[model samples]
Target chain A: MRDIFDQIRKRMQPPQWASWQTLIFLSIFSAATAALTSQAPPQIAERIISSLGWVFLILGTWWFVYEPDVKKKLKIYELFIGPWIVGALICIYLFGTWEGRAIPAPTAFVSWPPISAIVWSIPKFIQSDPKTKSPIYTTPTPANRQNIILVLLANLLISCWFQLYFEVQDWLAEYPSFRAQGFEQSAFVRELQPPEKRLELSRGVDYLDAAEKALKSQLEGKPWAEVERWLSNLDQEFPTVRDEAFAQLSRVAENQLWNLNARVISDAYDLEMRAIWQGPSARTAEYSLTKTCRISQARQVSTPEQLKFNSPTPPALSAQQIRSLGTVQCGAASSPDSLPQP
Target chain B: MFTDVLPLRAILFQLLFIVLAIAIESIVLQKYLGIGQKTSIQYAATANLASTVVGWLVFFTAESSLPPSWRVQLIGYIFYDRINSPALLIGLAFSIFIGTFLLKVQTINWLDQILGIRKPSTVEVQDPIKFRGRTAHRQTFSELPNRALGVLWANAASFSAITFLIAVRTILPPTNY
Candidate 1:
């Protein structure tokens, strides 16, 4: 064992091409640099070189693993020793992650080694000319079938890792309220930071605000006569208003995850809008944020024509005053306890 | 970013557990089976690594194939560190514990067979295995044929050590870290 260590030390070289260790270090360094540079703007050369370093790591490790052992490389010995080292490190992300479909651009940097290991199996199964980069016509070797199975299994794991990353991100984005909760009950995850330090995700409040504004714009500043007409025919008008509400929101809402309902109660003099969150949530019951846009008009009995007239100087009028054509005033969201009675 | 969200601590814990297992298993094998230090270490490391690799594979399969409702709990566990129910977590943990123990035991047997390693006769290596942690070291390497009983003892020791470690980590004030 001591002699083996000494032999490896003697074989170690400074340049990446001459030694696998140097190549591994270089690959790791380049991957770190790329990850750091990605946070800001990266230079074209830096990006290219960082990407190329991974390629070197892949090829270099493959060469070292297979080159010395073609004598008995296909046997169980090479299968365990060579790839296991690289695979152990690779397992960090693959095993720790919950799920993912495939390697995205950023993940592909450190992912090159296992991928190279997978690619190495190809030649073993079917002969290929390395220098010419041409496939030599040959059937997949039955003796090396395990190599094919191993590669397929590796890819399957990689897919789950990437998929899980995306899944977690999506889940958190939807249920921000769950972040503050304790993870003691969880075996897979835990809260590292306290509740105060974590980000405050506006839980459907922003959506409600958008919906209110949408309703106000649709109802406010209209001629009193037209306002009265539209209010009476809310069935015909509510669809467009609701559509506009959702249009102001994110495409991710897609009218399916979120639904905005707007209605004017003539008896109550309220243009109430409810933005119920139908998206993924920790709660069994969904959260519904309500914004009641008070429908008001000036105390003065202004004629329809007079109401349309522009006033150069606006008066400081509260709910007591009613001078404009009509006003749909919106304030903060109301509790989701119950819908207001019409 | 996804990189920022990576479970680096989990990976570190796993590596730490492997090292601890290898050490404990080597000690058990070296003392009980009358094997050389290097030989015992080799057997312990090989079985641990193989089991770990397979454990990850099983995790991926179960994760991807999870139903929609269970997937929600999985996401919650992965991201927010919360699970709505403890039943799933408990069941999953138990299964993994038993699965890994079996895998480790089988891997040792497989290595022994494939490598044509010679084991001492029942007369040379004879001792009873008391499941208790205190007497386990002294209790025995059983009269049964292969390295099965020895591997079981080793795996059990390693699992207890890892479980204690996990309990310690979980008990620590999360904010302090």
Candidate 2:
């Protein structure tokens, strides 16, 4: 084991081509740079990472290809490496962000490759031929130049396509109904809802249905003039219920706006008044008339109990309907406690 | 189920990755295969871009198929919203690396052919110097095993690097509240 260790140590000794001091310095610098960047703003960290990635690529290329075997440096630091690094940093500055914490850049992987080529091409670029001499740099030929442009165009096109795809996906999700009249809003609201939610939703639907039916039946054959009067009287009589009464009336109008079913809705004036009064609030007749109703004192009216006693006979209605109507407009049937007159 | 729609930030991140992967692959092609730098870049752009999209689709599929509890755990791991189970993270990493590797290889080959790089010469070449080295010979892409190994190595290296970077980010709590 000792002998093997000795052999490994001997083999691992620095090569003639490598500058040990420079390598150590660069490594430390890179580490320190990364550590410092860890706390920097995300944008700064991103740029630093991009730059460090390039630096690593440069070093890796040097260690693997140009240094040990060649026993000579590429020596194109000023002409190629420096400029490439600067250009790369600038590009990254413009395009890179750390917010996504995603893959840094497309060129990140290729950073070393281009640098390697440039290193190899330096000698060719600098002079007519350096075959007999040590090559320091690689040349960028016309073909290389054209290839660069084409590659750039290709990348741009791919980016545009990706952006388009992303936009389309977002659009589809944002307006799910764009595909078709998709499920109603209620369907979406109903997802993952508790078991009891079905009951609640049904109850809401029932209430809306009842309210709508009451509104339509009350406004079936009335003129707009009559509706206006009923609504105006409602506003004066029960200001709190007026908005709802008018809104429901408008819905009825709009529902039949362009249809043959459209008609000037009218109903019994007193019935309309009673329904509007009983529709939401169930105040006693005297309390409702005195405090809420806008009708004049000249109108001959009496409480349902008083009317029941005075009449010889009274109309019939179910207990539920009477409770719903909340008035004696249907005569004896509207009073649950009173016996029918013979 | 998680919404199929990707956030803008997430899409942008994928785009950035695609760009980086293409650039790196192009450089590798140029340096190792003697392909013109631009041609290599163009090939890389198409290959990497396709691979990125395919990778996301695969990831989405995996995520969607996973049980809801598992998906939530995975998403939690992804956002560092909670401490991640090592087992889950390892499994996720393995799947991601493998998925990316497979898609990348297939895409590269498909795009290479479509891009008219059907049979590039891969003549074995030695280093300029006759000395002891870690890697002495460069085999052409024509060698199927070598190509596979090369692609595997690249993908593994990239995946490991990214995983390490992400782990670091996870470990270091963001400075901003």
Candidate 3:
């Protein structure tokens, strides 16, 4: 490690200060890149110049944070942590920052921009000496190696933890019904969301919308006779409709966690589809959301004359008896203590 | 340098999951398959690694063969944590469960075949002329009672435990798992 750093240091000697030519080159690079990527000049110039200035400030602070240009034992953070901070700041400024998604989440505690600077300043306050001059040529000792290894391991562990957090986020995003469940009995996860604020972002309504759209597209604009015939074999036909509706669901995932089933509430009057969530929950009980759909004669009358043609081909089905969704209603989330669990 | 070449995060996660699965499956195999603790652990590790290796191989093969749109989705899901479609995720999850179970069964049988049978002696003779008459015997395979079913139960238990851990992690701090 010592030999590697030594070689790197010898090969990559940074100038003591930014020269005029280097500054001009950086400015032109930033300008060209910004102009190529952005349509708005002012905003582009502002963001690009601001980021460049901040990067400069970060590197500047890193160099001058030490007490004097003298022989002093520099800690690891003082020597190397600036790049990490600058990287974080660049990532945030370039890509974006996000609002916390989980309960009791720490947004930037582990990855804030100024953390390196703060950490680097600590040794400066404690170990600063006026007599010290700029000769940091300490040989790598066993204790030094041990210290470096410990810091590396600690950083690795923190990165692994962040990766785990990302993994959980993936699971939750892919399987969002898990978010609806209670976590009181869980051993690994604990929810800190207040009781009153729970279930505020329930995806029940969105799921119902999908189910409703599927119901109308599948059965709404058909003959009443065909509708009755389909309802007659609800056992077989209901499953097809359920699959279609569930397929249309963009809520979380398909055929997993959330269960969608439909039955004729009133064969000719309305159809009721129930979406039961079979996912991890914070609550002890499960909830089912329902949506009711009906055919409306009024909507078909408003259809353009293009519908009268039905198909460019000779169609066998009734084209004139077009039906549209009417009085569609989605019920609130209700725990099905009495209803059979899907 | 090493970190750039290898996915350190993924390795960390895989080792953790493998360890957890191995611990649980070992216990399950010991009680149900009637194996000694050490043998159970060895079998579980072998089976888990076999399934994991096969899974990664399948992933790479599919990634290379799939279309650009699908490749994007797979890459995004794996690297960016972007679940483009729930159907893909659910199907992948279901396939992994079934695939792991079947793979573990075959691997456990293979491991059992090796470990359960006593290997023929190495047949080392310091004096080749003195031991000229000696012959080495062939090795044999051993059969375990209810090996497939035992692996099934163990697989199911470990999968459930892992799913539960993932579920619980939704509300967890970034400390344990």
Candidate 4:
């Protein structure tokens, strides 16, 4: 080992031709691999190729540049490059799926660390006064800047291409639906209704309408305290009315208080109110009637519950009663609880 | 004297190793592990970027890649991805960047080790009154590249194990099947 080291020390230096040869070999290997695979290669193979490529490139360059004598050169090659070559063959045997059986194409550009390292080391090796404190050669120079730009562009292009390809496939798969109703409309509908059945369209529309009415009343200069009162009454009359009231308050506050930047704060308040009102029992008619009455009073009108009780049954109430009964079983026959008669 | 000129060969070897490592990682190791193409690609890209950038920075800085400030900043940024809604993509991106940077740093150090590149320890002339004088006194340490190599090997090993798991998953039919 000592003799080998001494010999390597004697012959250590790289030739220019070797760099070009290495690059060529890499290109060929990449091309051959891609040709054989005919598609994006597997992950493990790609990683091994990339890692081993870097290792060999650096080690080879080190040996070619630094090894002084033939004995040293041969020894270094045998120790490092030999194992790599054998490993490559074994890897091909173990992992190769295709008949041609070549390495996979490299997705990235072929630049390696040793070249950059050497470029960086030049200044350190050449400067007469090591203590002069000059900037290291690794500092980006015009050439390096050009290289960097090239690399950056290549990476961007590759990434963009990959992204676009996947997006195009997704779009293509959904194109028929999009074409029938337009992309915007389809997207809007889809966003409103994921397949999980979490959102109900009819309920959503009703909630939106209630929200709008509440906002309109607020814009007409109804005080927040009045709105809160009306919302609380509404909650007592209509248990599910909290979402609408909160939505309305948020919309009105957002539009009216644009100058105050209070929209976020108001929205947060509304969210908190909704959380409290929508608590477990909000599904009860008692909770609903109380909430609706509170909101109606905040709107500075006679409570909607009074009007509702005086009039024939509101269609909204009938629907709400039906929904509540769907889940609650009342007797041996699982009968729904009847709405209280005024 | 020969050591002065062997950079070309070293560069070639490094390039070869990187490519091979990526291939092995993606095809053999990742496959066995049950990692799909997307995840494997992500890992490859991140590792590549991390290794390259860190290698360049360290070789130039005369330092190792494990400085506290850098670790805090770069690794911290990676951890920040966890909070994102679609975390996988961002996580992959962050991991790739860090992995590649580390790989590059390791590669250079590895070369230094194999080639026995040593820097002579000598005191530099300094201005006694200047605050910058202390900067000259700091000795730049280059860690052995084997550490970085070890990390890469570990990654490969883990990936390979994953591939094996995936292979087992596929080969052995499910009880339902």
In order, what DockQ does each candidate have? Answer: 0.06, 0.02, 0.03, 0.01
Q: Write the per-residue lDDT of candidate 1 for residues B84-144, one digit (tens) a residue.
A: 6778778877887788778877766666555556555444434333244645444344333
Candidate 1: CAPRI quality band: incorrect
What is the lDDT, from 0 to 100, of the residue A69 in candidate 4? Answer: 58
Taking chain A by itself, what TM-score does each prediction score?
0.47, 0.30, 0.51, 0.20
What is the C-alpha lDDT profile of model 3 across B53-85, one tens digit per residue?
667557646655886446444533443343546
- For candidate 2, the docking band is incorrect
TM values, all candidates = 0.52, 0.31, 0.41, 0.18
The numbered model that scores best in DockQ is 1
lDDT at residue B163 of model 3 (Cα atoms): 82
lDDT, candidate 4, equals: 0.35
Docking class of 3: incorrect
Which prediction has the highest TM-score against the true structure?
A: 1
- Chain B TM-score for candidate 4: 0.33
Interface RMSD in Å per candidate, to 1 decimal?
Answer: 6.8, 15.5, 13.8, 23.3
> How do the candidates rank by DockQ, highest first?
1, 3, 2, 4
Q: How many Å off is the CA of B11 in candidate 1? A: 2.0
What is the lDDT, from 0 to 100, of the residue A16 in candidate 4?
A: 61
Worst 10 residues of 3 chain A by lDDT: A100-109
Model 1 chain A scores worst on lDDT over the 10 consecutive residues at A313-322
If both were scored by TM-score, which would come out higher, candidate 1 or candidate 4? 1
